[model samples]
Target: MPKQIKLNPLSIYIHIPFCVSKCAYCDFISHRVGDFEINGGVEAYFNSLKTEISLYSGLLEKSKVRSIYIGGGTPSSVDGKFIHNLIMQLKSLANFSDEIEITLEVNPGTLTEEKLNHYIASGINRISMGLQTTNDQLLHKIGRIHSTNDFMTSYEAIKRAGIENLSLDLMFGLPGQTIKDIENAIHLVGILKPKHVSAYSLKIEEGTPLSESYQKGSITLPDEQLERDMYHLLINGLAEKGIMQYELSNFSSASFESKHNLVYWENEAYLGLGVSAHSKLNNERFSNTSRIYDYSKLLSEGKLPIVEKEFIDTSEDLFESIMLGLRLNKGVSINKLNQKYNIDFNVKYANALENLLKQGLVILTEDILKLTIKGMDLSNQVFLQFMED
Candidate 1:
């Protein structure tokens, strides 16, 4: 039998794979569903999720959950009752912290006042709404079902539901997006004053509709300089609004940082359930199969649906510790690395560190090592130097 290792203060992620319509830029595991499919598919999916949750009861019993995040193709698109049931089930199965943060991702088109109220009553304390761009033309071009007005309505409903911690997901560098478009979006974010904001640049993911259009020269994104300028604009604008940049793409007011995401960036253990979810526990990293039917069938047959698992070796763990830790503004602790790996970090990567420092990409203090402003932009270049052959 595998040794039972207690994972105290764990984080849980539940993936919901149904969306009313797929966004053009999306590459996540999600499917479009109609009313007929919603009736049967939603129930079947939730049943599989419950069975999967029970499979981890032994591990969960030994752990204390610190955060729970429900993410998806569009979690808010589902019937609110399903979400409520999932939360109630988790509450009954696990030992939750008194101050645990429960976040649910919402899309403007799918949210309703009643649904928001039901979420608030179900112990969900945080709401993350995807409002990629406020420009209706851009929204339609990107296959979003909702307009800026719809986002406003949903935002107001969430506030009226009495949920205080709210996050807005914004994007820049979309096809045909200009600086003015980004400025207008950030201006709206300032007006609403969400507790958190995630401003990400558009990446043309392979197999996505956006990528296909780019391949055919039908979609033209902003150039590299424009994207960088937009990022700087976002940083400066949000800073003036008292939303500090805590991560590369995330900003928040004081004490409003995302605790669930921090679990991943800090290299902490987390449990993931549902189709296409990923998990890291007991020095192992794994992910579930992306296919919903495959995931559900395996659970129905009394099996875990995980399709991939890797036991992280010592060197890989060290590399991940540095790579993930440096993504945060606080950076990594050199002393902790030295202690944990029993190797002098300064000596192990002396050449790489020296080159990075000379390039003004990183700073090494007495204890902590972190990326500089320029380094965060060229982070991939700096991180590549830490890779072990």
Candidate 2:
């Protein structure tokens, strides 16, 4: 059983590792269901997950669940009954807030009216659908299993199911994406008017097919200037549609922001379940085994299946808190940092802060320190400045 500790309202993340097909740029721990009966695998996995949840029942019963995020290799690809059962089990084990946000990540290809209905019945109040791009040819190039029509059908079904809280994932910097492609996507999203939007730039992860193609000169990406232009265009476009950019890549209208993701950016504790899942609790971080077979084997023998664990110390904790907190538009509270860490935030990194301020990359007020527009664009460099020796 996991350790029992009192905390503020906790968030839960459930990983689903099954997908219909792997995208060319994907490197996450996911299995493609090709000619295999996914039901059996899903059942077995859920069984293990239940056992894992049971191990934390004591801690859960003592804590109120603030949010639940069901994510992964196309969570919509699996049977909705499995998801319903998982939510039911969690509810049985925990004290869920009446207004708790429960979100499920979905793919356009796997959505159905039946599934959406089941999801609604299961207490999933939010749907995050991946509609990476509106270009059918670009979608095909990325090995996406859905077309624009499929996305439209799924989106309509989500609305018909009475799910008002929706989040759409869009991507730029694709293999052949253009400014027009992004404009078209943003326009479509504007028409749909989802509560939230996550606009990201595609990165060619090493060892993925996309990276291989990039190295072989078969894949060409937008130049740095063009990519920057696309990012700004998306920001301006979404803003014009009344979507507030709350974080670097996430935008929302009023209270429709992603509560579960905010847990991470706020540096709060969360519990992760299933294969390759990660958890941060009690000032420690740990992760489950990545291999499904290994995860199953350990769980079957009544073990926790933890493959990695790190006990965060004070310095590391402070660093992480600042690093993650800076990702948000609200930025980090200087007062909170001083109160918690007992260090002069300005003095510790005076030189770095001076250089960043001179470049108009950051702003430091009496109570808050945050990235400016130029700072967000060069956030990586800003983040590097805060690293402790």
Error of 2 at 145 (Å): 1.2
Backbone clashes, candidate 1: 0
Query: Per-residue CA lDDT of candidate 2, range 1-389, in tens?
Result: 99876646899999999888989999998887543353577778888999889888888988899999998887888888889999999999898988999999998879777788789888999999999999999999888989999999989999889999999999988988999999999899889999999999999899998899899999799998888899999999998998989999999999998999999998888999999999999989999999988988898888998999999998998888888999999999988998898998888879988998999988989888899989999999999888878
lDDT score for candidate 1 against the true structure: 0.91
How would you encode candidate 1's per-residue C-alpha lDDT over 1-389 as one tens digit per residue? 99976648899999999889999989999888574273698889999999999999988888889999999989988889889999898888888989899999989978877787779888999999999998899999888999999999989988888998999998999999999988898899889999999999988889998888899999898999999999999999999989999998999999999999999888889999999999999899999999988999999999999999999988998999999999999999999999988999999999999999999999999999999999999999999999988
What RMSD does each model have against the real structure? 2.8, 2.9
TM-scores, one per candidate: 0.97, 0.96
Deviation in Å, model 1, residue 145 alpha carbon: 1.2
Off by over 4 Å in 1: 1-7, 35-39
Q: Let me know the TM-score candidate 1 reaches against the reference structure.
A: 0.97
lDDT of each: 0.91, 0.90
